[model samples]
Target chain A: MSRIQSVLQALKGQGRKALIPYITAGDPHPDRTVELMHTLVEAGADIIELGVPFSDPMADGPVIQLACERALEHGTSLRQVLEMVKTFRSRDDKTAIVLMGYLNPVEAMGYEAFSDAAKAAGVDGVLTVDLPPEEAEDVAPLFAERGLDPIFLLAPTTTEDRIRAISQHSSGYIYYVSLKGVTGSAQLDVDDVAEKVSRIHALTSVPVGVGFGIRNAETAAAVGRVSDGVIVGSVLVDTIAKNQDDIEALKSSLVNLLKPMREALDELAS
Target chain B: MSVKLTEEMLRALPDTRGHFGAYGGRFVSETLMDSLMQLETEYLKLRDNPEFQATFDKDLADYVGRPSPLYFAERLTRETGGAQIWLKREDLNHTGAHKVNNTIGQALLASFLGKKRVIAETGAGQHGVATATVCARLGLECHVFMGSEDVKRQSLNVYRMKLLGAEVHAVESGTKTLKDAMNEAMRDWVTNVDETFYIIGTVAGPHPYPMLVRDFQAVIGRETRRQSLEQAGRLPDALVACVGGGSNAIGLFYPFLTDESVAMYGVEAGGLGLSSGQHAAPLCAGRPGVLHGNRTYLMEDENGQIAGTHSVSAGLDYPGVGPEHSWLKDVGRAQYVSVTDDEALDGFRKLTRVEGIMPALESAHAVAYATKLAASMDKDQMVVINVSGRGDKDIHTIAQLDGIEI
Candidate 1:
C-alpha cells in the first residue's frame, strides 16, 4: 500500500479521521519549509499537503495567490521544493507528504524525471489542481508506478459521472472541493458535503477528503464526521500571510491553530 | 500537448473534445468543467440552428456594422513597390475593433442560454469596450476585469467600458496584466458559474473558448475571402494579421487554412527583440506548455514559471499564444514571426501617412511584417492585411512614448 493509503487506512482502523493541513513551501522562507512540515506532523497532522508555488495559481483565491507570490519571491524552484521534502523525510518517515500545486512545474520537469525526483524525495502523493482525470490518463500511472499516490480533486459542481471517473483514476484520496468557488471560499455547508461524500463513497471505495473551506475546529470535526480526511488550506496559509516578518510566531501560530483542530478530530472518535 | 496534424486533420480540428492536435484541451478546475461542457454543447447546437445563426448574423450586420470594408491600400502598395496590398477594415467595426464580432456572438449565446450576467477580461480594453457595448444592447449585466496596469494605461477604453454601463474591476494580483485579469475573471466565473457566462476575448483559454472565439471571429476570413475574389479577381497570395492571443489572426486565417496557395503569417510583438527575451512572441521564441486552460507555446523560465512578457501593444503582451496557433505552427501550416517595437511604430506611421489610416499598435505588428513581406513578392501578387482595430485608443500611449503629455 502507498504511504497515503496506509495512513488513511491506519487512521480508519483506529476510528480516527485524518487531519491534513496544507502550507505553501517557501512561503515564509525556503529554510522554514522542512521545519514547518515537521511542525505539522508534531501538531498531529496525518498528511502534509505542501503547495509547490507557481507564478499563476488560477484555482486559488487571494490568500494562496499571495502566498505563491511570497514563495516565488524567495526564489523557490520545483527542484528546491523536492529537496525540502527530502529534508523532512529524513526526520519523519511515517508521515505522508503530498505535493499540491498546478501542473506546469512538473510538465517542465518531464513526468518521468519528476516522478523519479518525487519518489526520491519520499513524497507520497500529488494533487494537481488543474489536472482532472481526463488529462491525467498518461501522467497518473507514471506517478503511481513509483508508489506516489495520484490524488484528484472533485468539486461540488462535479456530476456523478465525473466523480466515478475521477475516483477510478485517483489512488490516495479524492479532495472534494466543499464549495462551488476557488480555494479560500467560505461557503462550505457540511450537510451538502456529507451528501456528496456519501454519494462518492457509494460510487467508489477510494477514501474521500474534503478541502477548500474547513477553517475552524467545529467545521473540521463536522466535515471529519462524514469524510475520511479534512483538508485545511487557506486558514493556515492566511496565518503565514499574517505573520510574514516573524518566523517563530508563524511556527507557533501554525501549531496553535492546528493543535485544536487535531484535538477536535480525535474528540470525534472518543 | 504536441500532436502532429495532417491536412485532413486541420479541417476537423479541435476534435469533439477541443484538441487542436493536442494543443487545446479543457485544462480547468473541476468547478468550471461543467460550465465549459455546457457552453460547448449549447454552442454546437446553436452552430447548426438556422434561427440562432440568423440572430447572430443580424446582430453582426446591424449592431456591429458587419461587412466591414475591404479596401485596396493603393498608395501603400505603390510605396512598398511589390505586391498589391488590400486592407480588411476591421477597424471600422462598431466599438472601433474586431473584438465586437466575438462579443456579439457570445452575448447572443449567453442570452440563448438564459445567462443574464456576462463577464469578460481585457488586456488593452478594446475587448472590454466591445463586450460592454454588446451587453448594454442585449440588456445583460456586464462585468469586465482589467489588470491594474492596463486600467491605468488604457484609461480611455476603461472609461468607454464604464460609459457602456459595465462594471470595470481593476485586478491587482500577479503583475496586474491581461493574464492576471484573466485569472480574476476565471475566479469570478467559478464563483458565479450558474448565472454568469464568461466571454473570453481572445482565441486562447480552454477548449470551447479557443474554438468558440475563433468561430465568431471567422467572419473576418469569410468576408476577406469574398472580397478577395471580388476585388482581386482571385484569393490573395498571402494573409497577415497581428496575433495577441491570436483571435484576429485566427479570424482572418481560419477560412484560408486549406488553401495551399495562400501563405499565412501571424505577427507577434517584438518588444525589444526576440533575442532580448523581452518580447511576447511565444511561437517564435518560447516552448510548448500548458497555461490558461490549454497547451500552447509560452514564454516561461526554466522552472516552468510563466515569465513576464513585454510589448508596446498591451494586447500582445501575453506570455502564451492561442493553442490553435501553436498547432498551426507545429504542423507547418502557418509561419509566426515578430517585428520589433520600433519597427511597429514605423508601420503605425507608414499606414497613417500613406493610407491615411491609424492602425492599433497590435495591428501595427502585422502592418510592419506585411510591409516587408510585400516588398519581396511579385508585383502581380496580392496580399491582404487585417487592420484589426482603430488606433484612437493607442494615441495616449503613443504620446507618452514620445515623451508628450496628453
Candidate 2:
C-alpha cells in the first residue's frame, strides 16, 4: 500500500483522525530542520507537510508568510529542503512527508529534477498550492512516474465536475480548503466545510484532508469529525515563528494541542 | 523607411524558438515551459487570423489613438542647428504614454481567452494606468502591483489607477522596486493562472511576452514609416528612443531594423555616473543573467544579488534591460548610449521651453541624446525621436528640483 494509504489505514484501525502539521523548513535554522521533522512525527503527527520558502508567497497567510521570511533569511531553498528530507528519511521511513509550497521554486529547479530529488528524499507526495488540476498535466505525470502522489485541493467554490477532475488526477489524499480566503483568515464556516467534505467523500475513495483555517484544537477537532484528516498550517507556522530558537518547546506545545484533538476525533470515530 | 515588412520576413525574423537574432527565447521556469509553448502556438494562430488582426488594429486606431502624429520640432531643430528634428508623438496615446498600445491588444486577447481579471506589474505607473484603463473599458477586474517605493514616488498614478477601478497593491518586499513588484505579480499569476491574464508592461520577461509586447508596440514603427514618408518624403538619418525594458524603443525600431541607412540609438539612464555604480545602464555595465522571467543583461554584484540601480526618473530605475535590446546592442543593429541625470534634466527643461512639450523624465534621456545627435549632424539631415510620454505627471519632481512650489 501507498504511504498515504497506510497512514489512513492506521488511522482507521485506531479509530482516530490523522493530525497533519505543517512547518516551514529552515525557519529556525537549517541545522535543526531534521530534528523538528522527527519531533513533529513523534508528536502525534500522522503526516508532516514541509514548506519550501519562496521570495514571494501571495496566497499564504501572515503566519506562514513570516515563517517563509525567516526561512529565506536563513537561506532555505527547495534544494536545501530536499536535503533535509533525505536526512529525515534516514531514521524514519514510515512517516509520510508532503512538500507543500508554490510552483516557482519547483519550476526553477525543473519539474523532472525536482520530482526525482523529492523521491530520493523519500517524499511521499507534493501539494503545490497554486497548481490546479487542469494545469497539473506535466507536474502530475512527473510525480506519478517517480512514485510520488500529486495532491490537489478542492475548495468550497469547486463544482462537482471539478471535484471529479481533481480526484481522477490526484493521488495520496485530497486537500479540502476549509475556507474561501487565504490560510489564516477567520472566515471559516464549520457547517459549510462539513457539508463540502461529505460531498467530496462521496466522490473520491482517497482520504480527504481539510485545511486552510484550523487554527486551534477546537477547530482541529471539529474538522477531524467530518474529514479523514485535519491539517493545521498557520497555527503550527506561528508556533515555529514564535519559538524558532527552541524547536523542542515548539514541538512539545504543538503536540500538547494536537494530542487531545486526536483523542476527541477518536471518540467521534468510535 | 518605406520598406514594407513581408509576412515571410516577419516569420523569418524570430526564428523557430522565438529567437530574434540571438535575442528572444524561452529562459524561464521549467513549469512555465509547457504554458509558454501553448502560448506560442496560440500567438502564431492569432497572428495569421485576419479577424484577430482587424480587431487588434481597430483597437489600436480607435481606442489607443494610433497613427500618433509625427510633429516637426522646428524651434528645437533651429536651436540644434544640425538636423531637422521630428518627434513621433507616442505621448498622445490614449493613456498619455506608449504603454496603452500594448495593453489594449492584450486585454482583447485576454477576453478572447475567457479571462475574467487582468494583472500587471508597474514601475513608473504608466503601465499600471494603461492596464487599469483597458480593464475598466472591458469591465474586467484589474489588479496592479507597484513597488512600495514607486507607490510613494508616483502617488498620483496610484490614485489614478484606483480611480480607474484597479486594485493597486503596494508591494513592500525585496528592494521595493520594479523587480520585486514583478516577482509578486508572477506569484499572483501562478496562483491564479487559470483565470488571470498577466499583461507584461515591456518588451521583456520570458518568451511570448517579449515577442508579444513587441508585436503590439510595433505599431509605433509602422505609423512612423507612413508619417515620415508623408512629411519628409524620406527616412530619418537616425531613430533614437530611451530604453526602459526596451518596449518603446523596440516598438519604434522593429519596423526600421532592416533599414541600414537609418541609424538606431537607444538611450540608457546614466543617473550619477556609470563608474559611480549609480546608473541604470544595464547594457553598458551589466552582464547576462536571468532575472524576473528571462535571461538578459542584469546589473548584479559578484554574489548575484540584484544590485541597486539609480536614476532620476523612477521609470528608468531598473537593474536589467530587455533581452532583445541586449542582443541588438551586441549584434550592432543598434547603438546604446547613456545620458547623465543632469543632461536629462537639461533636456526636460529645454523641450518644455523650446517645443512647448514636456516629456516624461524617462523620455528626457532620449530627448537629451536627440539634442546632442541633432547638434552633431548636418542641418538637412533628418532625425526622428520617440517622445514616449507626457511630463505632466513629473511636474512635482521637476518643480521640487527647481525649488518651485507644487
Candidate 3:
C-alpha cells in the first residue's frame, strides 16, 4: 500500500483520527527544521505537512502569512525546502509526509524536476492550494507515476459537478475546506461540513479530510466524528508563529494541542 | 542652512536585510541575482561619495527646482468648508510630474554602476517621460516598455519618449497593460543584466528598490516640510496623496508617518465601485502575498494566480503594492481608501475649472478623496495634498471620453 493508504489503514485499525500538523519549512531557522519535524512526529502527529513557502500565498490566513514572511526573509526557496525534506526523510520513513504550498515555487522549479526531486526527498504527496482540478491534470499524473498522491481541496462553495471532477483527478485523499473565506476566519458549521463530506463521499472512494477552520480539539473532534480525518492548519501555524524562536517550546505546544484531538478521535472511533 | 544627515539616522534607514522597516529587500530570479548584488554594492559605494551627492543635490535644486512652493489653496478650502488646504506644487516640477525626482536619481546611479543603457516600464507614461528626459540630459541609451493598449491610448507619451531618444517597446502579452509591461521589463533585465539598469517607476518591486525609490522621492516631503514651515509657519493637520504602486504617496507619507498629529491618507483607484470588481485597491480587496520581489498585499485568485486589475487611471492598475505601504497598513500608521473613476473624473474637471490645474487621472483620485474629506472636516484643521503630476498627456483620453476629438 502507499504511505497515505498505510496511514489510513493504521488509523482504521486503531479506531483513531490522524493529527496532521503543518509548519512552513525553513521558517525562523532552517537548521532546526529537521529536528522540529521529528519532534512533531514523536509528539503524536500521524501525518506531517511541510509547507514549501512561496513568495505569494493567496489562500493562507494571517498566521501562515507571517510564517511565510519569516521563511522567505531567510531567502528560503523550493530547493531549500526540498533539501530539508531529504534531510527529514533520512531520519523517518513511516510518517506520511506531504508537501503543501502554492504552485509558483513548483512552477519556478518545473513540474518534472519538482516531482522527481520531491520523490527523491521521500515526499509522499503534494497539495498545491492554488492548483485546481483542471490544472492538476497536467501535473497530477506525473506525481502519481512517482508514487506521490496529488491532493485537491473541496470547498463548501465547490459545486457537485466540480466535486466529481476533483474526485476523478484527486489521488491520496481529498481536502474539504469548511468555510467560504480564507483559512483563518472563525465561523465553521459542523452540520454544514458533515453534509458536504457526505456528499463528497458519495462520489469518491478516497477518504475526505476537512480543514480550513478546524482550530481546536473540540472542533477537530466534532469534524472527526463524521469526516475521515481532521486537518488543522492555522491553529498549528499560529502555534509555530508564537513559538518560532524557541523550537523546543513550539514542538511541545504543538504536541499538547494535537494530543487531545487525537484522544478525542480515539474515543469516537471506539 | 543645510540639514546634515546624522550617522544614527542614516544607519537606522536600512534595516538588517537592507529594508526600511519591512519595506526593502531583493526578491529576484537567479538570472539577475549577481547583477542585483553588484548593483547593491555599487549603490552603497556611490551613496556616500561626495561627488554623487553634490550632483544629485545640485540637479534637484537647479533643474527640478528644489523647494517647490507650498501654496495654500484658500479657494478650495472655502469651497470644501474644511481645513485650510495647502498644495505642494510637484506638478510644477520639470517633466510635468514628481516622477523626475526618482528618475534623475536612478539615472545618476545607473551611470555610477557603469551601465551603458537604462531600461524602465511605464503605465501612465509619467515615469517613461521622466526617465527619457534624464537619459537625454545624461547622454545614456534609454529603452522603455509600455503596454500596447497604453501605447495607443497614450500616443503623445510614446512620441515624447521617442523624441527624448528612448526606444519604446509596446508589450502585447497577457493583459497588455502595466503589470504585463513590468513582467516584460523584468524579462529584459534578466536577459541584459550586465549592461542595463532597470529603473523601476514606483515604490514597489524587490529590495533596495522600495527603499531606493522612497529615498529618491523623499525630496517631495523634505521640501514640503520646509516649505510648510516657511508658508504656514507649521506642518499641516493632514496629508493626502494618490497611490498607484505608491511612489508618490510613500514619498509624501514617509516623513509624516512618525508625526502623530499629521493624518496621512493614501487614495487608491476605485475604477467603478468596490462591489463592481473593477478596482485597484490592493489593501482593501487583496491579501498579503509575494509578487515582483518583496511580500505585499496583492490582488490574486484562489490559486494564487495574479489577476488582471482594472483602474480608469492606467497608473493605478497594478496587482500589488509597495512592501513598506503594506507594513504601514498593517500597523495602522496610515489610512488607505478608494475613490471611484466617476469621482476622479469629477475631481479632474473641478480642478481644471477651479484651480486652473489639469491633474493627472491618477492624482485625481487623491483630489476626489480630498474633496469629500474636506467637506466633512472642521475649518480649523490644515490639509496638504501632493499634486503629483500634470494631466496634459490625458487630454486625448479626456476628449475621447467627452466624444470630442483632441
Candidate 4:
C-alpha cells in the first residue's frame, strides 16, 4: 500500500480521525516551506496538502487567491515545489504529503515527467482541483503507474452516478467539498454534509475527507464526526498571511490553533 | 481548394463528452460537474423543441433587429484594388455588435429555466452591455463582471451596462482583465447555481456553452449565405472575421463549413509582434492547454501559468481562444493570422474615411486582413468581412492614440 493508505488505515485502526492542513508551498517566503511542513507534522498534522500556485486558481476564494499571488511573487515554479517536497522528505518520511494544484502546470511539466518527479520526491498523492474524472481518464492511470495516489473531489452537488464514476479513478481518499461555490466561500452545514457523506460511503470503498469552510477547531470537530479526515485551509493560510513577518510567531500561532483541533478529534475518539 | 470533409464531420463535434478531437473537454472542479450536466440536459431538450426555438427566433427578429444588411462595400472594394468586398453589418445590431445575437438566445433560455438572475463577464464591455440589454428586456436581474483594467479602458460601455441596470463588478485579481472577470463570474454562478444563469460572452468556456453560443450566433452565417446569393448571385468566395474568443467568427463560419469552395480567415490581435511575446494571438502563436473550463490554444509560460496578453483592442486582449477554433485550426478548416496594432488602426481609419463605417478595433483586425485578401483575388470573386461591432465605444481610444483630447 501507498504511504497515504498506510497512514489513513492506521488512523482508522486507532479509532482516531486524521488532521489535514493545507498550505501554499512558497507562501510568506520560499525558503520557509520545508520547515513549515516539518512544523505541521510536529503540531499533530496527519497529512500535509501543499498547494502549487497557479496563475489563475479558479476554485479558490479570495484568501487562497491572495496566497497564490504571494507564493508566485517569489517565482515559485512546479519544479521548485517538488524540490521543497524533497527537502521535507529528507528530515521526515512518515507523514503523508499530497500535492494539490490545478492542471495547466502539471500539463506543462508533462504527465509522465510530473508523475516520475513527484514520486521520486516522495509525494504520496496528487489532488488536481480542476481535473475532474472525465478529463483524468488518461492521467489517473499514468499517475497510478508511478505508485502515486490519484485523489479526486466529490461535492454536495455531485450526482450519485458521478460519485461512482469519480470514485472508480480515485485512490487514497476523496476530498468531499462540504459546501457549494469555490473553496473557503460558504458556511458548512454539518447535518447536510453528514447525510451526503453517508450516501457516498454507501457507494465507494475509498475514504472521504471533508473540507471547504472547515475554518476552526469547532468546525473541524463537527466535520471529523462525519469524515475519515478533517481538512483545514483558508484559516491557516489566513494566519500565515497575518503573521508573514515573524517566522517564530507564525509557527507558534499555527501550533496553538492546530493543537486544539487535535485535542478535539482525540476527545471524539475517547 | 478546401479539404473534403464529411457532412457528419461538420455537424458532429464536441462528441457527447464535449471533446473536440483532442481539445475541448470539460475540465473543472467537481463542484461544477453536476451544474454543467444539468445545463447540457436542458440545452439538448430546448434546442429541439420547436416552441423554444421559435421564441428564440421571434426575439432575434423583433427584439434584436435580425436580417442586418449585407452591404456591398464598393469604395472599400475599389481601394483594395481587386475582388468585390462586402460588409456584414453586425455593427448595426440592437446593441451595436453581434454579441446581442447570443445573449438574446441565452437570456430566453434563462427565462425558460425559471432563473431569476443573469450573469456575464466581458472585456471590451460589448458583451456585458449586450447581456444587460437582454436581461432588461426579459425583466430579470443582471450582474456583469469586468476586470478593473477593462472597466477603466471601456468606461463608455461600462456606463451603458449600468444604465441598463446591471450590477457591475470590477474584478481586481489576476491581471485584472477579461480572464479575471470570467473567473469571478464562474465563482458567482457556482455560488448561485439555482437562481442564476451564466450567459457566456463568447464561444468558449465549458462544453455546452461553446455549442449553445455557436447555435445562437449562427444566424450571422445563415443570413450571409442568403444575402450573398441574393446580392452577388453566388456564395462569397471568402469569409473574414476577427477572433477573440471566436464567437463572431464561429457564428459566420459554422454555416459555411460545408461549402468547400469558400475560404475562411480568422484575424487575431498582434499587439507588438509574435516574436516579442507581447501579443494575444493564441491560435496563431501559442499552444493548446486547459483554461477557463475547456482545452484550447492559450498563451502560457514554460511553467503553464497563463501569460499576460497585450492588444490594442481590449476585446482581443485575452489569453485563450474558443476550443472549437483550436479544433478548426488543427483540422485545416480555417486559416488564422495576426495584425499589428498599427495595421489595425490603419484599417479603422481607412474604413471610416472610405466607407463611412467606423469599425470597432476588434473588427478592424479583420478589415486589415480582408483588404489584403481581397487584393489577392480576382475582381469577379467576392469576400465577406464581419464588421463585428460599431466603433462608437472606441472613438476615445483612437482619439487618445492620435494625441487629440476628444
Better of 1 and 3 by TM-score: 1
DockQ (CA atoms), all models: 0.85, 0.09, 0.02, 0.85
Fraction of the true interface contacts (Cα pairs closer than 8 Å across chains) found in each model = 0.79, 0.04, 0.00, 0.79
Clashes by residue pair, model 1: none
Runs in model 3 deviating more than 4 A are: A1-270, B1-14, B18-24
lDDT by residue for model 2 (B1-406), tens: 1333345665675666656655555544223445556667888888788999999999888888888999999999999888989999989989899999999888988887789989999998999999999999999999999999999888888999999999999988766878778877876765566678889999887678888899999999999988998899999899999987989999999888877788899999999989899998889888775566555787865424457788888788888778788877777778899999999999999999999999999999999999999999999899999999999778878888899987
Q: Residue B46's C-alpha lDDT in candidate 2?
A: 87
lDDT: worst 10-residue window of model 4 chain B: B1-10
Q: In model 3, state the lDDT of residue A167.
A: 86
TM-scores for chain A over all candidates: 0.98, 0.95, 0.96, 0.98
* lDDT of every model, 2 decimals: 0.92, 0.82, 0.80, 0.92
Over B1-406, each residue of candidate 1 has an lDDT whose tens digit, in order, gives: 2333346866588888788876888889989998999899999999999999999998889888899999999999999999999999999999999999999999989999999999999999999999999999989999999999999889999999999999999999998999999999999998999999999999999889999999999999999999899877999999999998999999999988878788999999999999999999999999988888998999999999999999989999999999999888988888999999999999999999999999999999999999999999999999999999999999999999899998
Q: What is the lDDT of residue A167 in candidate 4?
A: 91
Instruction: Between candidates 1 and 3, name the one with more favorable lDDT.
Output: 1
Provide i-RMS per model in Å.
0.7, 7.6, 16.1, 0.8
* Candidate 1: regions farther than 4 A off: B1-8
